[model samples]
Target: MDINQTTESYLLNAIQNKRLSHTYMFEGDTLETLRRYGMFFALNIFGDTPRNQSLLVEGNHPDFYYLHTDENSIKKEAVGELMHVMNNKPTESEYKVYIIEAFDKLTPQAENSLLKFLEEPPEKTIAILLTIDKSNILPTIHSRAQHVHIKGQSSDRLKELEYLSEADLQTLDVLSLNAQHIKDTGENFTKLRSAAAEFSSKWINGHSLVLLDIKPMLDLCAERRDYSLLLQLIDGYVRQALHSKLKLDIFEPFKEGVKVDNIIGVNHLTNMLDEIEQANKMIQFNVHPMLAFEGMVIISKG
Candidate 1:
């Protein structure tokens, strides 16, 4: 079966077999993509009838609750409101479904507020929490929900990524398959990725002062969020290098230059990826962007 058909079959079988979980964490590509799957699964669970479909499409479905926020972080108040609404019984259907998009964006208070509800949701109430990255999700929440990894775009979908070279596409495919995110980031995506690739290349080649050498690239970032993206891109390159070194099912070798497998040990690359994740978290927690970058480099070097 094709990608669409494959996903449809999975959902249909889940519904037919009456195997739906009380809580699900749909992890993958982008919020938009996961939302589509979440809504599809919700509709299927609700019988896919015309009236139910219209109600859901128009956001008037009494049995379905949708929660999303325009800001980066979702507050406890918002989640509490959802909990309050979900506490009631479904009016129209045997099951009530609630979908929370960008679940990774929930603040610590919000996640903590949700723990009890998720752990003991009202009977016949199904919760679908969607996230682009599951790493940011709290361990408590992660443990409570059944995780579903939505597969990324297929090869045919590569047609939409015409802006990136074949090698670039291969590199990014392992990192993220969200074409919209690349389009949203626009030129900065390409530049930051290039900067990251260059930085990784130098580090693997034993270049001293690799961190200082990338200062010009750092200066080009006009926004603090850029640091997060830059760190993510660096992590991606490091991962790609690790794959190359391990002789895994990599599409291409590290795009920058020499292979790092011989130069850097697998454990070191793994540790570097961990440090990069820490740097990204530092950036998320309002650390000075440059300091986070420098700290990652200094700590990795040590």
Candidate 2:
């Protein structure tokens, strides 16, 4: 994946501040891309001059070491070899940096062996481990390393769209839609998203005449697809509020935030989703969109 502004700013800040961690775990995207970025970061650490970059690219940097395995797993022997080399002081730069590609492929024995090295890394030594999946790494190793997740192509595109959040992309993902879909239907999506936020906010605030608010949403549904999208958006909002009530980290796309009082329990939120589902199903049966949506609000209120 291409580097986006977030990644660029993050790397720039870290490099400028010299806030280098002893060990870092880079996760996400392809292994090759992570490795390339990992090397780029390592080069920046020493001084990203053209000469330094060339040395690293040509594998001629005395202070920079790269390890990769073609086998199914990285063996203990490979890690032991790394330990031997890391023990020496830097030949050229003030810091010695080593990058291990496919870190998740390290064998359990290798991981255990590496943990000792991480516990007391050689003075002025840094380790950069690249992995596609973090779950395979031991918790002990994870605890000692700072993690950086590289966003994929889709995520990069979503980030470029100023109006959408990761949570919003996830909602579209559930519907088998994507960033392109949002771009094509930007206006319509914005309307539905706004309406959902407003309606859910009023409902959760215990507005006495909140049922009347459905008219605006019903008015927006010019087609069956629009009506279905509206119901899904509202369902998403309520689900977000329910997650918030339970103190879950589930992402809420609405920037204003979702709130739930003590009175509204999980049952209420579940029933609301059910009502939306029923209303959405009505569209397939040729039910009048306004009547069906109005019925949903009334039932949800009751």
Candidate 3:
């Protein structure tokens, strides 16, 4: 499904059946998407009105908690705040939801503080860690909570155009097969951080080359939100994937260090490819397309 369709349908399903998970990791590459889902969950699940939604913006959600990580790392006090919030009972709703946006940025000390809470979470508290990457999360926290791997919305029109550029008449395809991989590696922004360090010289040397073709993907990378710095790297990598996997002739320095796995089926790849375009459009309207495309590229690399 496309980005608009996916969110619409998912929210519909959630509202229709109330199959809301207590803790969700709305893992995507865009900060906007992160906050968008945060709002969606708050408004729908807690029945907050437009006025209350404004309060959520001001970090005043009565039943909600926002967690942030500074450039240095997530502060130890953040965990303390969380513990305080969880210790108390729900104020307005059955679930006192916590939206831990960017929890993966937590410092080691910050992460450690929450081990006890994750193990035995408050009976009525639902903690959703909105993250681009969960690599930093402790195994203890990961194991205790139910893992909801919110994959990227399916590929959009840009992806469809990507596939159409190939010379061969349907000789091979990248979409439809990597659905699960897309979910697992949704918006592999974490990879870009390491890649930059690992390939700085190459990236710098190819700076001119990268700049020439980085604009389109960069445009789709969304605004310079919290995850802005890494968006360009991500955009470039997807360009590499589109050219490499789908056989498009995009010229850029290919990134290394990842073990490419090309075993996904056609169905998953097409769906993801289609969603990529929808996500791009959404990004044009201020939606975050980073993670959605990131997921597709990760899956395609496989």
Candidate 4:
């Protein structure tokens, strides 16, 4: 039940005034947080009590439908199945509620199918689409839904970062970094993150000559064909460096080992992030992984 009070109040007011929209887009810093809010909102709509709240929380409610992908992405068939269920009358509550997690991961076909459903949602039914990256959602679908932003209080950032080590914060998928992910992935992720931090530190410090030292790591990325993860790691490092220069009290180990202020200005860091993004796009267009990485590193030198 713990969520952004402002968001909760706004939704409550909408419900009280009978102004709740048929389709809602819930955006937050992380998927888990948005999922919690989605569940809270659904329970309220169903007039759920403490005794029955467990059913909804556990996703066992007849009227409540939860959609997510266990595979790489949500396909068209999944959307069709969901539509079939949604077309049916609510079994218990007055409203049938569907919460779709990772909404941005839906394939193009699935997205088109979902758009049709959103355009003409079933009566007495609500659809909640959750995502960390709003930009990934199609503009056509975005235009049709009410947007809700769930934000934690500003003072909570330090507390949230407290549980994370510098490496965890640096290497984390910035969009999905949370305590649970850290706990579940554990030390292996941290080690990979540390490797990224080391790579970034050496590159930023004019130690491009040390490429030979990290060639094994680069080879590993090329062999695994996960250039995206490497790019994200480097992006995280740059973000941490920017935050450090801004005097934010976030955990950034590079602040201690390297004089970030001396090596790169905020402008340069910003451009480095842009370069990394372009390199990621290149990989998507079939550029060789090592070539993309080298190109990005060279661009960062500017």
**Structural similarity to truth (TM-score) of each candidate:** 0.65, 0.53, 0.50, 0.65
Model 4 per-residue lDDT tens digits across residues 6-104: 888888887778888999999765666787888889888888587449888676888888999767689999889889998999987888989899898
Clashes of 3: 25
Clash count in backbone of candidate 1:
0
* Candidate 3 Cα deviation (angstroms), residue 120: 1.4
- RMSD of each candidate relative to the true structure: 5.7, 13.1, 14.0, 5.5
- Candidate 1: C-alpha lDDT: 0.78
What shift in Å separates residue 253 of candidate 1 from its native position after superposition?
10
In candidate 3, which residue ranges exceed 4 Å CA deviation?
A: 1-3, 146-302
Best by lDDT: 1
lDDT of 2: 0.77
Model 2 residue 293 distance off true place after TM-score fit, in angstroms: 29
lDDT of 1 by residue, 214-268 (tens): 6877875766666776776777777777777877745342355344636578888
Per-candidate local distance difference test? 0.78, 0.77, 0.52, 0.72
Measure candidate 1: CA RMSD.
Answer: 5.7
